[model samples]
Target: MEGGVMKEEGNRLAKEQRLRKAVYNAIITLSECIVETTTLQRTLNNLDQSSWMEVVEERYLGRMCGFPLCTNPVQVKNAQKYRIDLKNKKVFERSAEIDKFCCRSCFLRSAAVRAQLEAEPLWIRGDEQVKIFDLNAENVRQQQQDTYDVEFVEDQQLITSLEILKIGDTAESDDEDNDDETNMDEEKKDDAHKEFYNLCQSYLTMKSAVASIDEIANDPTVKRITDETVTKMEIEAERKDNKRLSESEKLARIRSKYSQNKFKRPPEIIEAKPFNSELCDKVPENLYQDFKRILSEWCGPETICHLQLHRRMNLSDSENKTVTEAKSIIAQFYAGDRSINKIVEDVFLPPVDNVDQAKQRISVLVELLKPSWRLLERTLNRNGCGQQALEIISTFRLSATNVILEKKMCDLAVAVIFRLLAYCDRSLMDFYPSDHIVSSKFMKYLEQIRCDAKCYFGILSIITNKLE
Candidate 1:
């Protein structure tokens, strides 16, 4: 971020330098034109350092197109002569222009006599004057950086260093007064405690605090520490604070502070994970699948699927209602969510312009599968009809493949193969300890064909022959 800021600042400085050079040359030429140098100089002089940017920016910084209507800048070493059509009065020059004239010939419109401009160049010596203008532009920038300006007044009343030292030193020594068996005289400690307690109660009510302060100010029991009493060895303590309070008043202040400390004590510290530069990408398999895994770990029993959206108009009431309900689902599927499959389908088979097929062809064999699937499963379990069932299944697959029907027709073909296998109580995804068939490779073949579910469904059906 610092490098980016420095680069931006450097670019700005370079641009400013370029603009300053142009403006200087323009100013020198202007001073020569009228035989006077003070008008712009006066404008520069009147401008405050913080406000001169507007004057610098308002000055034209580059050579512009000579064609009257166009204010576009000219970058070429030699600008082309301006050409215009007589009838329409449109200037012609090329700098990424897009117009009706650019696309085609304009021979129909008559050409006009070209306008010419002539000006003699004059050299001048005005560096001292223009240098000041450049410096003022820089000054405008520097003036913006001075953000802090308010000077705070220092409090200089007598808060001597020994008082601050006393506040710290009392931490250990003051605890002795709270105990009954302390060596300090019992009456003296009780008297000090009573004075501190009364001071606290008066301060809390604050009604007679001023009067009490006046009466207690002259109390001889208050041991005063004067400038001479605070020895040279304790002079370092003076630097902490300049206030010098009497011993009795300091004890009251310490009791008051300790009473308040209980309410403002900070909360317990919590352990935080340390910053780590090395990041581990746990799933190198797939990004989309990894995203689902991460969210699954975070949410656990509460399952969620990603639903990305793009720029769109307001959804209809029906769509919004359905989407919200689907988003709230807690149960997840192993394969993928419905939306992921839909997106994959769209990518692999983008909808053609006019080829959004309305319906699939209903072959007679395809029609028969709806009812015959169960009946075929029953008969194929017996001996003779096994090859017959296989032939019928193959015929259905070939017909559908040749016709190029939609995905559902292909799925119906796979259903036939699974039904016979199920009738015999064989299955995939389950392990029956005594059963021979626990899983099938047919599902894998179907996936390899991207779930088109090929119509070759009858190859794996079991046949049992009874010996007579």
Candidate 2:
């Protein structure tokens, strides 16, 4: 009884399984028919260089492939496992496997070709559009420029108005204020320019050591070739000299006969007497002192002579004061008695025999001038003898050695130095030694006179005039 029941159950189960299989087959067949008629598969004739396409090899299984030959699961159409034989260009849609053939890759290539063709028109259209846009943009830019030119003056006026409004809010609204500051700056610059001009002018005034500078520029003779060229020329010259020398060998042989002649040898040393303190003592004390003082006192308004004299005499400050007092007494004596021209003549061309005599002459000159200058000042109201008197006073200051002389000498030295500076060449100013005592003293004198740029420049002009 159990065997019959079990056999019946197995038969029923088998029938049910067969029925399920038949139904699944029918559904697949209908799906294949639907896909075949739907025209879902496409062929591309002009594939673009870069595009994506899918090639179907099987339906329902979703088997596909692509160019450069890739396979993935894809759907098939027409109840066929579509396969591509790419070399043949034939589409096979069936459930049969073909040798060395892929449906997908061929379809993909066709699709890509079709896509490339389709996109060509769109790319051409885009490029044309860009060109048209560029032309329009250029036209617009030109129109804008024309418009700007038409309204240029108005625009400038508007800008000026805006600037004026902005300026009104600032502290520096006054144009004159700006002008004043500008003038100040210009004045400063002018002063500097004048100084430079004065320097150049002064150089022009003075005698130029480089007198041949311009001639050197213009002269063809000045330019020379290289040393090697000169050497070559010399060699050629030597060759020419040697051409004559060959014939002179006979003369040379004649001269060789006298070569044995010789001259005398002289003694190396000679002796003389030694000592002479008595002769040294023969130099008179007053003479020595007087001789020294001329250079010390008489260098025309420059106290450099006096300062140098003191230094050379090696006198202490106290001794210098005594010397100065004695000198003043001599100057005063000459001033009360002597004539100005006589003093002037005496100061420069002193008796050269003794220092005391020279001192006496210098004293007479200074003394004669001092009171005469004062008298000239009093007498010459309309005439310009005051200038001569001033000059005389300057000369007197150099010789006189009192407290008054120190200040007066300093002032006079300054005047003389400045006056001389005007006559100095520009190159000298640029290259002369600043460390030199005379130069330093001269500059110090300029500072003392409070000489400004214009005054110095006037002096320069005077110098240039003299030179011209």
Candidate 3:
């Protein structure tokens, strides 16, 4: 008994060791499988980060076959795939490389349904069939030969009966006497004559009424002038007569009444003597005569004499110095002096607060200088004084710097310079070369002035081109 018990214990020990070994092997195998699966999962996740991998996932992963009644997952498996051509009503087998339905049964089922639909007659679901049947019945009834034949036969019978009745009535009328017929015809003629006479009377009365209406319509005096129109005409006529008489009679009466006054000679007139010699000597000797002439032309002799007398009275006081300076400048310029810089300094340097007033003053001076400049140009050209003309132009060009600071003065200066250039081109080109010293100086001054202000760049360009 002891030996059996020991053997049983040993057997139990061996069974326990075997069971433990099996359990340990199972645990190791499960751990290795888990590590392999995790590594594969990490690899798949890394691949899914790429765009093409995502497309592959969408193409195959979690996508089912696009086939009717198909529940199989689309994959590279044992099933044959196909594509259904709905337009051609055909089914074609596709390679496993293509992404489409996975099963041939689905394609075949779809094709069978398409063929069945094609084999069936075209169907209308509303009352179209009933209406078509009714139309066909109506057409068949119209096409039956008996229906129209019967209607035509009845019409012919009715027409024959009407003709027979008309013949019988004619025969009965023929049985009557010709005298009765003649009496009836005479009665009809009398009635016709009476009606015609009545119609003729009515026509004549209507024609007379129409003629009277036309006469009334054709009357010229229908639209007589209103009282207002007649009054206006009378007023106009009276205005004309009054104007004629007033003009003629007023002139005649004035001539008759003031004839002595018109012909009367004034009391013996005393002419004022010329300006005092001391005052005349104040102007330069060469310019005195021209100054006196210009002063007389600009201001009358009486005014000039008054200015001279005033100057003489205030000889020591510089109160009205501008008037004297203006007189001297004008005199000097007209006397063939081209000292425009000094003239501008004297005339244009006095600052004016009012721009409009300054512009007005500049405009007045420009107008006054224009005639002198024109006369000078003519005299210089006639005497062939092209160099003197250029000197005068240079003086004006230097003066334009001060003038161009004002907008209006700049525009006027541009116009005057353009005119001067034209005059020089016409009158002085024969004497001077294209790139003469005067022309170069003038162009340089023009470029300088143009740079200083934004004025007449176009005209400057044109002048430069012409000079070049």
Candidate 4:
């Protein structure tokens, strides 16, 4: 009885399992029919040079592949860009527009063709022939400019010819083989020679040397050193031309030299205390001293040294005192002490109607940063700065970015940005922020008050002038 019952139970279980399998198969078959009826897949044409497509930059992640015909999953490891390309027509739903291609084949087949982009971008192209022609012309012009020149600017830099250097570089080339090394054209070489000649000629106005056995006894550009000054009297006294002179006389001379050198050496400089009746007597000595101490805290000691704010270096006593007064005035301005005119008469401290008076206040600082501004301008205009520039005329000033609707000013701002990368590479201008308020770039533009300085300042003076 137990065998018969167990067999009947096994047969019922088997029938039920078979019925479940048949239902599962039916559902899968219906789903496959639905997919075949509703969907279409087009076989891609072979990718050739003429049919080649390039992926644009700025790929993004999406739930579905961006390619209109593709249904593949996007892999995180591979970045792909997609765009519709066939006849430049975009029929994909807006939601699917951002979806990127899952595979390289989809990208190659659907992305805008590199050749067709010259005619017009695939997604934006229309049946408008006029716009298409205009774009093609522009692209052709751009293609012409794609070739880059690899020439160096330093090649054009004027080398000082040590040969005939004192006489100046003439129309002659001394080295016959140097013709191969020379990089400049005829016009550039001529200009370089002219510039070098002019620099040498500037020293013509200097006075002749004093009569002395010393080779450079009175060199003006150089400070003579015995070290400092070997006096004419000392030079002459040291000469022992008469060998017959008594031993007592020679001993006396030696004794005199020892005593004089120890107790009464000649002064290197004539010392005089400067006293200006108008300026020095009225300056706030106590307040200015306090300002210098505070200045170091605010501006750091290095700034004081770089700008010579602590004391104007390399000036005569009278000039030194005058420059100290000017620096004090600048310090006062920095300290927000606007009543500088009350402290030092006839000298204005900003907020002045007279432009010259404004310039006079900061004349001392301009003499410091003229070289940095020069480097910025020259580097911007150089050949290998990675800029496709024919003309760049303006200062790299932050203030000029405020011009409203002026095309010329707009061009200048763009030029500054365009040249910035090149400027960073080549310019000697400091990129790091200056530590103190006094040495900051905001305070750049102290200028030389000479004809050469004026010529060099040129357009940049517009920015530097305000700093002065």
Task: Give the Cα error of residue 394 in candidate 2, in Å.
Answer: 14
Mind giving the per-residue lDDT tens digits that candidate 4 earns over 159-211? 34434333323334435456644653678667756877775565442333333
Which regions of candidate 2 are displaced past 4 Å?
1-353, 356-412, 418-427, 431-449, 456-464
lDDT of 4: 0.36
Q: Following a full C-alpha superposition, what root-mean-square deviation does model 1 have from the true structure?
A: 32.8
Clashes of each: 7, 25, 0, 5
- What TM-score does candidate 2 reach? 0.14
Between prediction 1 and prediction 2, the one with superior lDDT is 2
* Model 3 poorest 10 in a row by lDDT: 124-133
Q: Assess every candidate by TM-score.
A: 0.15, 0.14, 0.14, 0.14
Give the range of the ten consecutive residues with the poorest summed lDDT in model 2. 126-135
Q: What are the per-residue Cα lDDT tens digits for candidate 1 across 347-412?
A: 233345654221222244345443434433343333333333342232221322244422333333
Model 3: residues >4 Å from true position, as ranges?
Answer: 1-266, 271-361, 377-427, 431-468
Candidate 4 weakest ten by summed lDDT: 390-399
Q: Kindly list the per-residue Cα lDDT of model 2 for residues 1-468, writing each as its tens digit.
A: 899999987876776565445434433332342323112222122121222221222232333332223333333434536878899999986544321124544443434333333343322222222111111234455655786785333445445544644535434635546655544555755665566566556656566565667765565554454455788999999777767765578578568878667877987886777888666434233432342243234443233332233233333334324446566446546544332345446556445565555356445555543543343234322233334334333444343353123323333333433343322223223322432223454444344434343444443343234333
Which portions of model 4 miss their true places by more than 4 Å?
1-55, 60-73, 78-100, 111-127, 130-468
Candidate 4, pairs of clashing residues: 66-99, 66-100, 225-228, 366-446, 366-447
Question: Candidate 3: what lDDT?
Answer: 0.42
